[model samples]
Target: MTFRAKQSVRRFILGTAALACACAGTLSAAAAPANLAYDKPAPTINPKLTALSKAMQPKVYKVSNRVYVAVGYGDANSTMVIGDDGLIIIDTTESLTSGRAVEAEFRKISKLPVKGIIYTHHHMDHLGGAAAFVQPQDAMSGKVTVISQADTMKLLASSETAKANPLFTRDIMTARFAYMFGAYLPKGPEGVVNNGTGPAMVAGPVGLVPPNKLVDDTLDVTIAGVRLHIVRTPGETDDAISVWMPDLKMLATGDLLMGETFPNLYTLRGAEIRNPITWYRSIDRVRAFPAEYLVLSHGRPALGRDKVASVLTNHRDAIQYVHDQAVRLMNKGYGPDELAAAISQLPPHLRDDPYLAQFYGSVSSSVRQLYASYFGWFEGDPTTLNLLPPKDRAQRNLALMGGEAHVVAEAQKALAARDYRWVADMLTDVIRVNPSNMNARKLKAQALRQLGYAEVNANARNWYLTSAQELEGAPLQIQNDWFRGVASPQARVAQFNAMPGRAIIGLFAPRLQAERTLDVHKTLAFVLSDSGDQAGIEIRRGIAEVYTQAPPSPDFTVSTTKAALARLAAGDTTLAHLIESNAATVQGDRQGAETFMSYFDPPLKDWSDLHFTTR
Candidate 1:
């Protein structure tokens, strides 16, 4: 091995050991002052605004004589419509515990049997708690019909499955979730004030029941004697749908149009860029309806004919305004960040309009997403195509900036001037170079805390504060063992099962030792005996090609159950153990098969636990 490679490995090992030690007792070792002045919320925050934000609480709103919505039960809302024969529910809170709370409260208003459930989209918060409303057995037996877009299962499963690239890890995703949801925030005014979606999330296992019926397009149907027109609204997700109750003149728009806040065309937690044109088209359809009342998934119901129309129009106008202006600038050759900065705020007339508040989605993320949707990520800059990786860039930048001390000193000056954003950017490189710098860590925490406190957007605040807690060396339990602690084994296995088999095999290429395998040519045939699905793989010079079946000549064939194979692939078990347990059998050459497994490395990648994650 070269000198630099060996030194890198040693540095990695040492850094990991230091992180473990920090996670164990750093908080006490680097305790903050008994009353850290900067720990308080920013002095500029409006008192009235904070109180109004805290007023978000769980309650049932009667939208009409027949329709009611359970608001703020968790980070989502559930709407129930009572019919002559039974009841129909639209959306459910985030988890089973939260769903049960809303269900109990809903029973206070009506005791009618649940006849059907309508999921607006493929988001977990919108439908993860379906089981709390109705038993799975009932849905499976056709007692209660569950309906969603036909692509719901495929889209939902794709989201939950493992990433094909190691650069995108679940820990990073979970870490982003922690930031977006304020998982690390304390339960009080000082932290976790409100998630724009609702009051807060409830702790419990997520309950999911797959849809039994599918809605492919515009369908006019009746459930439990309630006349409804379901429109496929492709905005937040491809499987998004909206229900319009013609009889009652009520339109139930799920997260399609959120509460007194700007719609999130792009989420910081990472998601596909929402198509602005499609979203505007969907809003226009809702505007065409003469709805007297509207049920939302996060905020209070919009009542009265004129009031609902005005609200819907304002939202539509804002969406179109951003899209139109953004596209015009892109035509003039403005890149994403430039366009984002230019369109920092809405027009004055619409800025303070109740529906256009920057509570959930900010203009920065929106402009970027819209620009990408229209022009794609390439900015016509050739240098960016061959950009340096993060670590290398950080090292070079820090070296040019006269090392960590110079940057930290400048950050201290920025902190003194109350410029939190500058402080964050200034200290980022220093921390990346050496995360063990206690001084830099604490300063960065203070900057993030102040920024989070002063921010108006819920997601931005949650991320800033959560990141602050991390720099202060706060340890998260789930951050340690994500799969075992965050979700059940069955759920994890189901995600793996839903992933395309080709994607599963493609993940192996990055782990192959091309240097060792440059001269070694080998072929392994994988056959799922139970499912009768087979894939033949040939690896040469670290390149892998997969076929529908085993080649005419293969060195060995490994026939096994998908379950055993998934377990081994997940690093949960070993191939030798599977062979010994009779779950797998190797024919032709057992030694060659075992050697093949060794040729390709298992995933052993991890990033720094500090706040600056790649996600």
Candidate 2:
């Protein structure tokens, strides 16, 4: 090896060791304090949210003689169905680390080849660890069939990067996702106690293998002497599916019945509005199955026919109740906030039902989402159509309320009275008028912390506390560490190497710097020598357009294997090094290729600037 190559290997080894140490103690370390004043003992937590933690304790549940589930190892659960000659793996959790841990426990049960891997949906938590359960060549060659709904690939493509229209980019979605899952916050009473749906969002390599077998409505097949039926349920996600085993009398519900929490009709992280009507109808379909055991992608499995029926019934009823009531209030000329207020809690039976707890999805957020689904953002108010900008509105509101000082004083009084919600709202105006005003910011943070402590919903609690931390100028920039912890550098390189050449090229468009590219027009062609796949990017004034066809006359062309591309994308090796090593060869001007690359924005390594609050 060359001197530089040896040096590179040494640096990678050292970097990997350092990353291992950071991830090893991540769960136990406290988030650094941005302001010492805000750092105190664990705040008072709602007893219900605290109690939910017990259900997430790591354990392997033996549902029956034929089935076993591993929960609390990650954000979602994985189930193994024993067959005559092989096993059927369902929903492989969220990360490679979690999947491997579950696989170890399953090995203790019975070692069998995974004949089929079923993805309940396209959500990362359900299918991210696919590589752990089955080999890529096996899946590609149909030795092990990977299955999912027909729409799964389409949805997955959208989330692969920013959309063409760019209404909600992947960056924004990821930022909100980090907050919703409490990715950066410390794990404790004052911070993230539990992920309502599971123990926590485990950070490690996400190995997503696209499905080879597609299911449209329902498919009945026998694998390894085990009869199975895969049905499209379409509840939490558009492509959601469920598996049923007639012989075992077991039904594995994906997110259709998300454990004990009320269905997440609308997630705070944001997505296409989950129509409550469609959701409940989907639940009704799953309820039709005569199953003795109910296994879930999240939470514990229900044993016995009666218990299974009861959980399904309550879950569907909860969705229908929220949907119908929100529509009823909407017809009465109530807006989103009013609809939420009118039906903040479910009826006595549902509210009290252990299965219908708002530990994951709250009624208020669902109501607001339901309203938005039926009626767009207008809310039937003409004045709201041309409302003042946020800054202007805040400035005017502060003037009407005497000024920043007066509003802060009033918020202080409200805080003293323990009216946290009002204090948060009033202080928001003052802080908006003067984002640098530390007093208003501090007061708002205090109120938010109190409100977070009282929330029964884990998602809301995490959001509240995360926002409060941001408001206190906490060095939330450290959140990038959690992102890095998701996968080792080598693991990430492998993941990118496994991606399709076209998809890899697609990821570059969203990062195009429009201003920088306004006067620059260039074409860069990528030819994967190993796979014979050709893709190209055209810099058209300000937009980077990606296509899979070979360009007629490209300004620059790079001939390399996908693995070489992966090393460059994962920052494991430089393009210059790859070229020097003959891993990649350039046709046409190499300097032009470098200049073309500079037109795109660099990857964001630190996300502290993407603040949830105090913007």
Candidate 3:
């Protein structure tokens, strides 16, 4: 038989087996008495889960008659639904190793086949291990239906932004690794036992296949005679969605209804700002369901109808409160910073609720995102309207502070006072001014660690600690090859052209002096190429306008891929080899090419002083 045919058969068998197992296991676990108020106030504290479980415990809990939910203690959690016919899964965890662990838990209870998979959103942590649950064949075939919102397919397809922007993604990954697995997830509050068990080793390729079924607004699917409702709501991501089971009275709130941490309205890794108003509205939509149990994508499941309702209500109120308060302050002409400081505390009732705590994101950041969304980044101060470049500003600040030593002293004072935020700000100036100051680097590292330790939000903690670790000498290796495999030259060219004029202009720094600037008097186009998927990009320059086009060759062509251009842009490597090796073929005038290269300013290695300030 052909490979395709064989694969199809394998998938059918797997799907059939999964279904049989789920059906056979349904009778193993007897249903617990309903409405029997178990005096046990929900096992809220598990020493192994304390640090990361503030949102929800890690233990498995019965959400409905047959459906069960197990919150992953590391990375994003996964929710499982089992019925007489088969099983449905939401969010697949970060790695296959962990995926196996999650599957094992389900198997221990039932031998059922997983009939369908639902993605909450397109984040890797939520859908990375789909292959483990449903087998490739089943996914390829129509045996198992994978579902997500209409926009989710776009997000999943373009999710390689993490791989494309390596520098930013690496920094975010470092932070994620440290917080989600290092000491936070396992240690809890008592203390940590460093058995050296790091994050589950994730090997093999990392790509999530698009769901087979797409839902724009709402979708109803009957599996094993169980009705499942999927609804879309804009929250952490534009394509986010939530799942509801009317028959089971269980609601699977992807990342929207995460335990205690505030949503990341503005991710530091670089994404569009999330709408706080819409986020609150989405939470309210989930509350509208007759959900007797709430199972979140990342934390423990909240059991009991009354308890679930109360939690969802409060979750909605918490976000709405922040949104409304921020709007009120904005109306009163309070700036972002002022508004953030004004509402430093949550409502009295929510302040201590484990679900409302800040373990992954903070209200301060959310306030800034809201302000930016409504008013843009400018604060209306003329002095700050057109600020000098960061390095230049650092240099000026250093001179005014009486040199590096003086700035270092101030940073030290801030550190002594435990004002890590100020220390980070002050030390950043010192590093920029005197890049070789070892003392400044050490102080900055310490400040970052303290900031990380104090952060209740996991992402914030990871960012701070990762920054500290990087300063302490983590290798700054850029993975150029990773981008080559996923990035499409044609798509990138389209994106480049589609970018706003201002965004394109932002790419050019005035300080970077090229040999000569080619005045683009008219629009010009160029061709793109790929070096074994390792490099691809369009080379374009003109007097009036310059842009890139996919596939077809332009009037003039520069043969190279986006990866090579990115490497050249970041100053990670030189392009002399490509030119000399004939790897880069140019159709345009050599002078124009030279001018284009010259315009890009060389990256500065010594932008910061370890002891005092930035230069």
Candidate 4:
């Protein structure tokens, strides 16, 4: 069978399995009573809205008397708002197929047109259905108004880099399926929830329609006669926004307020460290609202003023608890590792709150993030300040641990003792020393699974499970159907030029041996046709690479639109294919062409064999 045919079959099977599991009472109901084993008390329900899906799916509910929120397997949450003129949506679930299934719920409510869309954040589960909402032009046109924070635009625009991270957003997509979706949350077997059910799917290169109106602090607008109070919050992303309706006393807190789980201070996908202080403050800002009902971008809604206040209070306190503890240690001059160990214990109040659980994010990782954000990677020790390369450090550590076997054995002991953090560390060394260590891989997977199951933070759980999945085998590939015909060629060139010089250096590192050094002094520029945004980058070593707007004749002139670049970055096609197809062109130095290819460091090709532990 063709790849597409096989994928279709896989998706069908997975969807069928999910439907069966959801119908079998394996998934918990979103509005189950608090006293019930799986049901948490419904937070204050918005008086303006009534819950639908009473006959369709027990876990699915609706608001605005038009919008439908479906709680699916993996704790996956989707929202459909039917506006007076049309429908305005928030999140789109994990896949187009799943998103359509969500849309069907909306159909059951009302068949209003989908007029506008808002991506709470950039996570795939939330924003994967751009194509499903409307045609590409419709999304880009002012009629649809695909709104998001400016930072979210930056993230979506740099889709290539986001996908390139070691822990790609694909992992986030699947992990959400296993952990948050209804299959495991209310009550299910401890480790039976698996995220790897569907074929690989990547969102199309999204046409980043910046919010026509940018709100630094807050912005109030009415959609379909319903007033939405949008507020900026730096939680999962530096540019995160939450929507509220004072009239309804309802708040749609994008990723900021998951039903039960601590937020991920340190995400697995590599990025700048997030500030716990800022996260707490953002939650505090939301709590100031007279919100009676709370709906998270993920998980179920909280109904009632008291319940909403309670969840918000716990969420704020949980973040503050971590921040306060980390700050206390930092004041004592404790390093990242020290702070991580020191703040492992949570105060009983914070620990007992279901909202503060570590289902996604962990205390240890958050502590490390606090240190990294405040003091960077440098520790006080000079020897550690300027560290050896990763591979060298792994080799040295392996030798010190009496070679690979001994290191693996120690890792196993750590795993048995439930020392997952330590097991992860030891396995890192073993994997570095010997990348193909199957035993190390298995141990790493086990450690990650333990971490995933224990996490209260949804993002953290996803990260751990994703890591474990990578260890076991290649993750299913996400089809890049979304980007196929939507990218702009000029935008691709601009994006390539705008990539951070440090990232470019890292990408090229594999091909750049220590013995060979090239000092190419030159500046390059590219002007995007679509947005008319011009970006110029200077190439220099040691000195910081500068970005500007005055166009310069680059050493090599490569011409390709942003759409083509998106396809290349998404692994839809190769750089060579673009050149051969006349979609992309390069001029100037032939040697420069070769040099550029050297810099494109392919990410770890195998996702499944990423062993988590040394043992």
Which candidate comes out best when scored by lDDT? 2
How well does candidate 4 score on lDDT at residue 270? 47
Best by TM-score: 1
- Candidate 1: worst-modelled 10 consecutive residues by lDDT: 29-38
Per residue, candidate 3 scores C-alpha lDDT tens digits across 1-615 of 234323332332333223223221121112111111111222322232234433232345766668777653335666778867888888876444446656767788878899888988876667756776887668778888888887664443333223243222322333333333232222322122111111122222332444678788899898756798889977887778999898888888888865545566666545456777788889888888988888877656788889888788777787888888999999998899998899766888977666777655567877877788889978878889789998899889889888889888988898899888888887787787566788898898888777655554555554455456557665423221212211223223223222222222223343233234343321123233432221112333322222322334433445665444544444544555556666566666655554455555544432111111123
Candidate 2 ranges beyond 4 A from true positions:
1-43, 84-86, 104-116, 128-146, 150-168, 204-213, 477-483, 487-599
RMSD of each: 9.6, 7.0, 9.9, 10.1
Candidate 1 Cα errors over 4 Å, as ranges? 1-55, 158-171, 189-191, 375-403, 472-476, 479-490, 498-517, 599-615
lDDT of 1 at 158: 49
Which should have the higher TM-score, number 2 or number 4? Answer: 2
Q: Model 4 off-target regions past 4 Å?
A: 1-58, 62-68, 73-76, 80-88, 111-116, 130-146, 159-216, 382-515, 519-615
Alpha-carbon lDDT of model 2: 0.77
lDDT score of model 1? Answer: 0.71
Writing each residue's lDDT as its tens digit, candidate 2 over 1-615 gives: 233322333333233334434554333212211111112334467877666777666778999998999877777899999999999999997666667777877888989999989999877778766777887779879899888888775554333332343222545766787778776677676787777887665555556665778899999988878899989998877788999999999999888899878878889988656777788888889888899999999888999999999888888888888888888778889998988788999999888888778988989998888777777788776898899999999899889989988998999999999999999999888877788998888899999999999988888988898899888887774333345564346544544454556666766787888988888788999998876779889999999889887876899999998668767665577666788899998899887887787676644444456885775
- Between the candidate structures 3 and 4, which one is better when assessed by lDDT? 3
